[model samples]
Target: MDTILNLGLNDQTVQVLAEATGNERFALDCYRRFIQMYGDIVLNVEFNKFEDALERNKRRFRVEYDHELQPEHLKKIIDEYKEIIKSSTGSEFPQEPMEQLRKAVMAVFESWNNPRAQVYRRVNKIPDDLGTGVNIQTMVFGNTGDNSGTGVAFTRDPATGENVIFGEYLINAQGEDVVAGIRTPLPISKLQEEMPEAYDQFQKTCTLLEKHYRDLQDIEFTIEQGKLYLLQTRSGKRTAAAAVKIAVDMVKESLISKEEAILRVDPDQLNQVLHKRLDTKVKFNVLAKGLPASPGAASGYVVFDANEAERCGQNGDKVILVRMETTPDDIHGLVMAQGVLTSRGGMTSHAAVVARGMGKPCVCGCEALNIDYKAKKMTVGDSEIKQGDLITMDGGTGQVILGKVPVISPEMSEELQLLLQWSDEIRRLGVFTNADAPADAKRAREFGA
Candidate 1:
């Protein structure tokens, strides 16, 4: 995995391939990109300078992230990018195809510690030390005009664990260009209407890749004048909902066994989605602001202290649980409150994790608020608010609105459940979903993951 590889043909080989491809521009563009990436890693080019130069070239061409490009526009963009590198660096973009291959190999290995790459590793729990092995086979361009395109597809739905191939694509675009979600992307389903032949090919390819990988594969591929080129493939992640549905369906398909199904799900994720949520559509009265330790919209009379919160709940008054932070003793109040709030704690802090597991709405770490339990009021920055007030918090986007805006319940359709069943059958692993609240857990259970 730590090995660097030099790839591609020499001048004579490039010339031979150019004749075969009948596109000098395409060959050269690939040659240059390989050099740019590789040179930065192996030759130690200053990245900031490289980016600045790249930006100037992009400005020079007036190219946008927009994908609606004709054949001419794409050729110009690539040609100009090469022109920029030459002009900015005072050298030709390396044309010795072997040089390009060499640089690409170095670049991929170097990507392991790239800033964003580091962050991705931390979040995904990938080890920081495992270097990547660069893979360089043949260059495949999707922007070769009418018959060309690129797309990303997952063998199973990542959101609801549906068994169908789920993904998106853009015609006349490179493989990575469409997945960035820069501009609005066309649905993968669009291919059926736009190019039925291509659509059929993609569908069949997805099935083959899934079976070959023996996992929920996320694939990157392109069609160069109607022929498919698979650029890369890896396992895909999914929402808790999708996890359950897919696990069950995959069982039906005999892809996984009963015990395997249970293990497929992340127990923690299931816990998070089960929190009680305030009906998003319900209206709320404006009152105090504080931390939401868990997530769920809540509308109730303010209870300044845990004892009061518990007492009010006993009296059958829906209560807004207010706290600077909750201690173990406050558990009863937290359970009774329509929602819990904390003035402290990070996402991994007690309140944050508990709230997620409970599937409760919480806005935590709101440092601006100071609770005055004795006075029955809280100070939020310059404002002071009293007990008996109402407010709402959204756990999903971390938005706390003055009043309720609109709410919609998410119910899994039968098709979704069936799809996940297929995913379970194929993976031969249990696909339990994350959920903490009744609604969220119900949603997951409905999917049968």
Candidate 2:
């Protein structure tokens, strides 16, 4: 999706903004961000060019983060970014508010059929004809200063279905900074320390939203100048285990009935609930360890890049995608891969979140593995593994194994069993077994056939 923040800011409006806000540094920061995002998303300028400039200015100023750069440093970045856009697109940056708005809207509409969107719809079986809609709202600055911030929160834990506010936030940042994984974000719990009033309000708002929606809600919000504003909210995506647990828990809490709970769990997702795990008796060569981002085990030939992963998967090869870290642009490859291993990024990074949502095994922040994307190789200690090498990874344990190993299917959790029972009680149709043997028939019956 294309999100152009701080739009309609030009040399003229920038001055007016600085005067109105009484903060030149904040105004310039917003202007620079606008140029970088607008130039990359709308004007087709290379995003790295802008990033490189920002990095250079940060180093020149001896600062660590983007928020630390002063107004003068940001001015330099804005000028360089504008030059990059002009050179890359053969035109100057759009100054007219209407022109900027028109291009941004067009870009968003064009994203409806983008490769990632198409792949997502295909993988999820969403109708292609449903299309997409755009929502335009007034801009609110989360990068205003220390008193402002942005965050993404789920009413319940999307991983375990626990009833708690689970989220991450970045003070003095825009919404993108939280999800982009450019900067490690603080846990949502830290919000109470930084801005108590906003945190309290957000907590109450989340409780009310969950009550009103009667489901786990993914909420986006910004606190500008110590005042909170909700940007968006939707049904939160979750892992298969979480889905089953949440449905059962909601029923027990009297928030939903047994029939509704049964219907809420996707029948196809039960396979993920009965996810496979590495055989405990098997002796395996452990290559490295990292954070267990999702729960499952997968063994496949490794692929170094997203494009290769997608191509290999389409050709009927089970592949594990290895990367330094994944981004939103990698959804197609992520969808195709059986599992993912990353050298960087935490549990809530793009790779981890997407993998969990798709019920794919994932290991993140495996810093011991030195990845060389150009050579399609990864090295750990003295061992080197090339592309297409067979490997197994246990996302439940965060262990990357050297070769394919035996796996054992896990029993369904209690919540899943209860959910199945509820479904069986409410289902009107009768099920018949196609099994040819007594044992097969018995197993089918055990599965409520």
Candidate 3:
């Protein structure tokens, strides 16, 4: 089985969209991607055949496949892809959207068995048969014009647990592009500068999701012709610090009871917060800045990017991973590094989320820093530091400082005591904080009533 993103277009759905856009191209394109996905997924059509055809089609169009391909170009590929699908499978791409949709759903269900997905489940201890729900949504265009864009935003900072909405957006781009790291995504702050009205409305939506869900919400949305359509929303995962902070703060805001707040912080994530991080006060010569997706302090010899970070680490050298922006490919670098830094993406970006999941130190979205990997040096406006010169990144403060500074792992806050007490009283569980170091447990107990 394969994971599938179903295009739930029916005759009416297709007709309406075709009528609305006055262009059948867009609907046809969606229809084609769905059929290709379904046939490969449900029918088990040989992927190499499609892959070979796609490569030839891309070459014929003289356009990049997937990466940085303009929406117009993608539309052209869609038409060509439709031809290729019919040629390979001897069937026209399914015109019946709902049948197209059902097959897609089954494909998604089957994706659970894909080797990659199975490995993921094994690592995470997820059962194999429990399937992913298919979200058959109305296609909301984010590539309509200048008034359109797509983004994924969190109700609060998952890295530091701050109340600020943290996210990335791609103006005039669509969903998967934002995640694929095809083109560097702009920070949400860019939306404020470029599209103020949309940004404001976006904030309101974030607030609504948080308020209604009563927890941090991660939302995916698109603006089409200056109107926002929410594609999906779910309770967000947060860093240990942010989890604690948001939980406590929510109690102060009267959003949830103290017990609920205590329950919100996962013990595993709490262990992550307890790790010693790079201190923020030291001076940094400066390197290229990317999106500050994750938070924590770290220092190591500069490895140009994820690949070097991994190679150096496997060879037993402490290395810091630097990149313009990290994608799914950077997982190895993140795994092998003492820390991570990026020049693009936001707090909700893939690098940030994955880094947090691994409990690795990461600082992203630092536009002020620049790294010249070829020279093995990082520079700010006036200062430059060599690759192996040693520098530090502060995840909590969003700073890249010079050398390793002394880290102070403080005891837990007094407020935590009250919060956890409430949780223990309510849930009737022991509610112990998972702490690697003694200081963490002391801090946990410090919050006792």
Candidate 4:
């Protein structure tokens, strides 16, 4: 539903939708929704206008459910939505369906120049003129009924890198409901109890996806009236520790060659493995827990503003940057901070991706922490932490602790050493290095050079 609405559709997609649902009306409904959504998101038509129209129709029909509206009422909504668009833009909505499709395509092209897109491209070093690809796919309705649902899952635990499925899902809801934080979603495990057959099928699908892709997969799926449909799948992101463990395990499982395993782990991500870590055996006062977006540990004074974080960092004071959510504009502060904490955002959000790329410790989607930027403070339960107040965090466990906490330097694991050894054995080229000092030579010898 999201893809068709956002990207517009081609004949192929329409045909698939017709075939899947065996309802011509389903395709027509998709077109109607696409027009309204595209107009609101890309054509600058205020969404409230369309929303108000929908609410009015619901009331007039005496229907509490969106899907409960009669076909005629939905048709009325489409007409009303078009009128709203026409009035807001001082232009008539395209009467021809092909013209509407063309306009939507152009709007997607225009989005490349939008401020948010430009900032993301610049920050990520993506070429500005390369343009984004449009993928028009058949829609699957997760909000069909009690037997319908949507979810996102990882073949492995994203937080700890364990080779166990990790994800969240919402029943009788769209995909956006889970990611947008509109409501707290149930853990993926709950699905096993609620829908055992679907859960088993999903587990098999996960294994197949990972095996076919030759990597851990992040997958989105929808169950429509008890039928499972895979929406999308891609390689999953992980912290440096998790990356190392996964690569090593994959090699051991004979799923990939040692050379492939070695190549899989990013060299830059290794820096994250060297960061300080909280001792698991140590006791501390726990404030809250959230998604462990990046792995490491740090204790620092909190600062809400990015500019302030930069300023404090420049003065040699360790600081943790806190925000409701972060953008590419916060890059400077992210670079300066010892760690990062956010009240909102998931494992793949801007803050998480950036912090992991920079090898910084980060805890995101900490919903328990209510931040007030103007007040320069954040609260968890009855406790309030003001600006410049010291706190410690373990990005590996996603634990926020009050005040300073002792940490120890991370040591290279035996598994990592074995993986490197296997890599050396598999590669054609011999391992060699130039050592300028006795200390360097000693370290090289220790590494079995």
Per TM-score, the best of the predicted structures is 2
The 0-to-1 C-alpha lDDT of every candidate, in the order given, reads 0.59, 0.87, 0.68, 0.77
Query: 2 or 4, which is superior by lDDT?
Result: 2
- Superposition error at 409 for model 2 (Å): 2.2
Could you estimate the TM-score for every candidate? Answer: 0.55, 0.90, 0.67, 0.71
Count of residue pairs whose backbone atoms collide, per candidate: 63, 0, 29, 0
Task: Please provide, for model 3 over 149-176, each residue's C-alpha lDDT reduced to its tens digit, 9 standing for 90 to 100.
Answer: 8988888877766788888888766775
lDDT of 1 by residue, 289-332 (tens): 43333444555676778778878888898876766655444556
**Worst-scoring 10-residue span by lDDT in model 4:** 1-10
The TM-score obtained by model 3 is 0.67
Error of 3 at 121 (Å): 3.9
Better model by TM-score: candidate 1 vs candidate 3: 3
* Model 3 segments more than 4 A misplaced: 1-103, 119-125, 187-202, 280-284, 299-344, 365-393, 397-449
Estimate candidate 2's alpha-carbon lDDT, on a 0 to 1 scale.
0.87
| Predicted structure 1: lDDT | 0.59
Model 1 compared with the native: what TM-score? Answer: 0.55
Provide the lDDT at 402 for model 2. Answer: 94
